[model samples]
Target chain A: MLEIKNLHVKLEDEDKVILRGVNLSIGPGEVHAIMGPNGSGKSTLSYVLAGRDGYAVTEGSATLEGEELLEMEPEARAAAGLFLAFQYPVEIPGVGNMTFLRTAVNAQKKSRGEPELSAAEFLKLVREKAKTLKIDADMLKRPVNVGFSGGEKKRNEILQMAMLEPRMCILDETDSGLDVDAMKLVADGVNALRDAGRSFLVITHYQRLLDHIKPDVVHIMAAGQIIRTGGPELALEVEANGYADILAEVN
Target chain B: MALAKLKDDALAARLAGLPASAASGWLAAAQTEARARLAAMGLPLRRDEYWRYTDPATLNAPEVPSAARFEAGDEAPAFDGIDRLKIVFVDGVFDPAASDDLALAGVEIERLALAGQADIHWAQGTYGVLEARGQTPVARPFAALGSALATEGVLIRVTGQATRPIALNYHHVSDTSDAILHHCVKLEAGANLTLLESGPGAARLTKVLEVDVGEGASFHHIRVQGRDHERRAATHVFAQVQAGARFKSFTLTANGRLTRNEAVIDLVGPNASAHLAGAAVGDGDFHHDDTVFVTHAAPECESRQVFKKVLMNGATGVFQGKILVKPGAQKTDGYQISQSLLLDEDSQFLAKPELEIYADDVKCSHGSTSGAIDETALFYLQSRGVPRAAAQGLLVLAFLAETIQEIADEAIAEDIRSRLEGWLQRHAAKGAT
Candidate 1:
């Protein structure tokens, strides 16, 4: 479903290198977890794959379903089935959450040559999705992420992931600010979308999130490179001990 | 103090070609006083503190610069969906043939041409009263010029809840026409009225709208400055609110060579509320300015000033707004926000937000910001499959949504939003820098 070959990235405006020759791959219906400490280039991988600005891919290629992803614009990449759930959801002051979601849904549909959903149809679908996520009408009506609590923001991100239904989803620190219940709720939302045709790359530092949404494989990343790979038990090992033991062993 | 030689020359030249007032009685007296005031203040100069960011050359020049009339191309005119008493003006001249009859329940509408001829009229005390009061602390010489020279307008008086809004439609027909209009509105106690104005009147337009809101009266004003890309206009609105009165005005300006809109509001009674908001979108050779002042003279009053603009391709926008809480006006609430979204590096926004509080217990806040589109937000939208251009258009509209939200009517607000969307779509084709 997704492939990264020797992905090398550096800051566009600085001389610092972020991702140094990182490589990863995930098959359809598989969920992979990448765990690392702060400043370990985990977020950079997600941003670079998402086509965010200010990052230069010095050497590497990323493909989604065998189609080159790095060369396409962000929107084109999205249409090609790549979604990044941001660690910190942006707070847009005046754009309503519902409007943003509807626009995104219709935009993707239009780009894929699919007939756009009517307003009524879209509303019904969004309401059903939001209901399971516990997002009420007021939350959907408010400006996107403006004054939203930490849990609400995370839930909103999951809501987007559900609406877009991208084949290759990158969850970058989606569990960072969520409470236990919110984590479970978000995990439920993600689990509901998991199928043979969809895959996820969940990036986090804690094993608690893995407890809710089990991963097929777990990789330990450090110093801009993936140094180790294991199963879901590796996350529990990291949480029980720490990244220090793994770093020491890997070195 | 003697006026500078350059200022004197410009003022003299501007006054030389102006038509003499053919009014009589109270109207003539008001015009006389306005002329004397204009002579003393003179037309604004580039050196003046208030005009520093804007050049007054074309506005002060003797000969009006010709502006080719714009064809709106089959777009339904603004306020077409509303049931209104339409009063049409072609090149600042009242077109009775195109206007609805000046008869409505609970309101009296009269043409300025006819109202000025009457020896005694209800508008007698309102014609220049608020303008004179607003001249203090700042000299709006252009408003004085409009008051003194304008010969076309409408006089509306509301004694009860108006059944529908009164629409003043200005049509531009001649490239060299210099149109001046002065309108006076008086709302008696407990009365309610909404005044809607639209269109680009002429190559050059100078207009003054003075409104007097009596005790418990409410007045709503919504205006759309026309889209003639080369037109030049200077408009002023001076309103006085009595006890328990309400005043709300919102304007949408798009695509003009130069436009200066000034609004002055005085809350002279307790529990009065005044709100002034505007949204402007311009591209290339376009300059729009909004200068507003609100005064809280009584206790427990509230005032809001919200202005937003979207500029690109070297277009320029300016905002100078002030809120003054006078002595003894306790528990006053004043809020002001002015922001601009510059689509390119070349576009510019200049803002001066001021707040003066004489009362000890007052809540006043003002903020001003000018910035490019939010790159992160843009990415967030684009990553959702919205095209880059469509994402930009959405963000621009979102940036201006705060000002549009100030409109009390949902249908009117929707119309305004659609118009803004149209502007964005048209400009998107031209490509943002």
Candidate 2:
């Protein structure tokens, strides 16, 4: 469902290289987890795939179902069924969370030539989806992520994911600021959305999250390249032995 | 030589062309004093310290190019939903055909011209008196000019709680119509009243409103400037608060070629509170200014001034606000904040905030800021599929919501919000992708 061939990315205004010669492939219904250390270009891969600005893609191409992902604006990418759950969800002070969600949903639907949902229909659907994520009505009515706790923000991201229902999802460090219980709640939410027609690329530094989401394939990325590929057992091995053995093994 | 003291050619010519008013006895004496004051002060020139940020050329023009009459029937006039004592004025002339009976319990209302024509009237003591008193610390010659040439006005006095708001609805039907309206309001001790003003009176309009709040009384004033794109107006309000009194005023301005609103407030008694707020949005060829001065003369008083503006294209906004805490006024509290959102590269915001404190035991703070939209928040919204223009509209409304909440009444706040939303919808960019 997604392909990245020789994707070389760099900071737009500087010579600093972020993603160098990165290559990855994920089939439909497959969940791929990338394990890496700090500054290992894991987040860069997700950002480039989602068509974020401020990056110079000097070398290669990334595609989703044979469509050039880099050629679309961020909103166009979202309309084309690519979703990125930010590591740090921004706090928007004025826009209500419910209003923001509805606008986003309606905008995407309009772009795809679909009938827009009525206010009542949108509210009912959002409430049902939010129930699974433990988000109450108060959270939905308040400004988006203004004063939310770390765990609440992550859960809100998952709520958005469920509502949007994108075919390809990229979760960038979703487990970073979450506790064990919170992590399980988020992982369970992700697992429920897994189906034959959808796929996920989960970028994380720890093995605890995979313990819950259970990826179909695992890759070890260092510097700017994915150097190792295995199954769920690979994640367990890193959890037990740490990245030292893996880095040396890959080199 | 005294009459020749008016050096500015434009102001002198405008004053020379005033229509006759049947001012006799004390009313005539007051008008003569105001005329002398205007002559001495001349008109506010662009080089004047207070007028540096906003050029007064349009306000000083003898005859500004008349604006095309606007037709606004999409919805009922702003406060039509609420039951009120509606007094209508068409092109500065009181239209009895369109007005309700000028009768209400707990208040006395009279037209200014009728009072002047009468041999004896209560306006003898208070008309233009408060405005003359507001000339110190800084000179407001336009207010003085409004007092001198205004032949049409309303005089209102309240002794108890008013059951309905006093609404002034202005209708514009002439291109070259110039209106000068002065309103004098006085609330007796333990009284309560609300005054509402709306519509564009004329292409070039000058207005003054003076209010006095007695002990233990409350006064509220809410104004919505009209949406005529080529209209120009200058309005000044002078207010006084006695002990244990409350005064609150808010204004919403949109789509005027030139508009200036000035307010001068005095807190003369302990425990009195006053709050003044405004929100303005202008797009292309619009110049909006808010100049406010607040003084705390009595101990243990509180005052607040909040203003916010959204400017797009080549529109400009100006704010000059000051708060002064006099000596021996202990435990005084004052707050002032002015902010503007510049939607494009060409829009500009000019602000000047000043605070003077003579008492040591006082808490006063002031802040002014001008910034573009939050790019991070913009991207966050855009990333979730909100189009660029829609996201901008959301942010613009969010920025003004804080200032709008300062209104003490929710119903009025909601009315202003809907008006602002309508403007944003109409001005949304074309070819938005």
For candidate 1, write residues B1-433 as lDDT tens digits. Answer: 3456677778889988887898887789889999999887888888888898889899998898989988888877898888899999999999999999999999999888887987888887888879988999999999999889889999999999999999999999999889999999999999999999999998999999999999999999999999999999999999999999999999999988999999999999999999999999999999999999999999999999999999999999999999999999999999999999998999999999989889999999999999999999999998888888998989999999888888888878888888889889888987773
TM-scores of the models, in the order given: 0.97, 0.93
Candidate 1, residues A1-251: lDDT per residue as tens digits?
Answer: 89999999999999999999898989999999999999999999999999999999999899999999999999999999999999999988889999999999999999999999999999999999999999999999999999999999999999999999899999999999888999999999999999999999999989999998999999999989999999988998999999999999988
Q: After superposition, how far is residue B360 of candidate 2 from its true place, in Å?
A: 1.8
Which runs in model 1 stand beyond 4 Å of their true positions? B1-4
lDDT digits (tens) for residues A64-88 of candidate 2:
8888988887888888888899999
Q: Highest TM-score: which candidate?
A: 1
Error of 2 at A231 (Å): 1.8
Candidate closest to the true structure, highest DockQ: 1
Model 2 iRMSD vs. native: 1.1
- How many Å off is the CA of A12 in candidate 1? 0.8
lDDT of model 1 at position B7? 73
